[model samples]
Target: MKPLLRVVLVIDALLLLAFGLLFLLTPWTSLYNALQLAQVEPALVGQGFGIALLGLAWLALHASIDGAMTRAVARTVGHVNWLTGVLMLVWLIALRSPSLSAFGQLVGAVVAVVLVLIGLGGVRLAAAVRRREKAQAAGAGATGREQKQAEKAEKQAAQAREAEVYQTEPVTKVSPPVSPATGRRVEPDFTAAHQPGVVTAETRTVETRSTQTHTAADEARDAAADSPGAPRPPFHG
Candidate 1:
């Protein structure tokens, strides 16, 4: 928890404690007089016991909020505020009786207002605490989700990097050179095919082309010699 939130909680708790003490000590004359519609000391005395019970209940309520009470105590305390609110309303209604003096009615009204204000403040504080708790829980949940997504993304990126490394590395493959004369690719081992005075594939292609050219030239010379009307051609020409 944040320090500021802790401080606010502590302050609210202290305020509740003080209010409880005030409710306990304050006299019940207001309620008693309001009930009788007149100032009656005997009735006041009797009602004091009931008012004391209300105060005890108030104390127990705060103790429950502080986690200082057992589960049963907490459950009972849950009703304390409602009960007190009801009691205050009843006391005020009783004051409406014509028998009550103006002074008694006025006092009763004041007590009712004060009790209501205190209870309301407490209720507001409890709601604030609950709101804060919910907001923190939501924020924590969102952060966890973001962290999980980032981890998944990182894992995918690592796998991709490993895949790239695997593709670029060298692997064994068969290689063949092209034969110019046949226009075919061959993978022959020249060293193993050794023969006395034999030529390599590259040399053989060149020699064969030269021999064909020389044969064509000889054929042309023979045609020229067989032409009877042709004068003897100069050697240079």
Candidate 2:
């Protein structure tokens, strides 16, 4: 509750307490004078006590105001209290029993109207408060939802940017070349085709071995010629 409202409530309760105390403290004669009751019966005092108690109840109810109470209920109760106050004033005005009776009734009627207007205004104020609270709650909820969506979008955008960067990056490749000769690392020899058999290394080695064998055979033939039993050498070109 606002400070002003708290103060107003406090004042109302004080008024109620003062009125209650006044009713209890005042003598029966004074009470009858105030109400303008000629008879001054016990029932009249009883009625006054009841009105005082009703005021006290109204004060208590107003003092305990909280958020949980519905605006409608507050409005209804406030109007009821105002109506009852008006009725009490009317009862007092009627007891006056004037010849014209117009003046007192008019005053009483004006007070009743004023109190009723205040009660209705209070109802409107409560309803306004409720509306403002609802609007604030709605705005807060919307803001929270919007913030969540914004965060989600930010995260998704970051992920997308990372994926795009990865996609755009350059790649490298490596492989080995194949060779024809032996399908391996051996070097090819092109000179072997042009000089097919011009005393190649293998041919030269075979020729040298054959010449050595022939010279050995000739020496053996000469030795045998000088011996007793030997084979003769043949003459050839």
Candidate 3:
């Protein structure tokens, strides 16, 4: 579409340049007579119009070569070109200006038709370019959505694996609390009298010493009574 647009600009440039040159040469030659185009009075006025047309020609040519400028130039030139063609047709058919021969009027009509076609071509090309760009943007958006969905799917898969592990894993048994300082396994206390506390070697040693002390006292009392060294009651009632 862009390439086609450039071609249209080039064609417009050539046509504009041709007409500009013919008008520019009016003062010195009978060239205008060849085309049967009406010569403007005050040759200077025709020359000014020639200059303006030449500028338009250069503008179109430059836009064709510079890719960035073509769309805008094409739209502007296209609209103006068609309108100029319409006015020319009005003048030739309705007003019958310049009093040209039938052949000349036919040529003018052909040029008018060409202008209208070129202008419409530019307009259509710009519209096509716009649609192409819009389609590309929509495609990019779709690609982005696909990527997001893929990532989301992966994340969901990971979470599901975690949940499965949690559900299928074995439960651990609870154990009794242990003493940190003694490094001993502590058992819970019970209400029964015979239930013993932590029985270590230290408790056994203390019980043995108490039993020996009681046995020594009973032996000393019996020996003193037999030896008659112990005090006795003097009388009985």
Best by TM-score: 3
How many steric overlaps are in each model, in order?
2, 0, 0
Model 1 segments more than 4 A misplaced: 1-79, 94-104, 173-237
TM-scores for all candidates: the values are 0.44, 0.49, 0.62
What candidate 3 gets wrong by more than 4 Å, as runs, is 152-237
RMSD to the true structure for each prediction, in A, is 10.2, 17.0, 12.5
Better of 2 and 3 by lDDT: 3
lDDT of each: 0.58, 0.60, 0.85
> Best-fitting candidate, measured by lDDT?
3
Clashing pairs in 3: none
- Candidate 2: tens digits of C-alpha lDDT, residues 1-237: 333333434444454564555455445666645554343245558558757655754654564474354344455545654775667566656655442245545655665665565556555655666787789999999999999999999999999999999999998754444554367753445676336565577667777988998999999978878997776568787
- Arranged by TM-score with the best first, the candidates are 3, 2, 1
| Candidate 1 accuracy as TM-score | 0.44
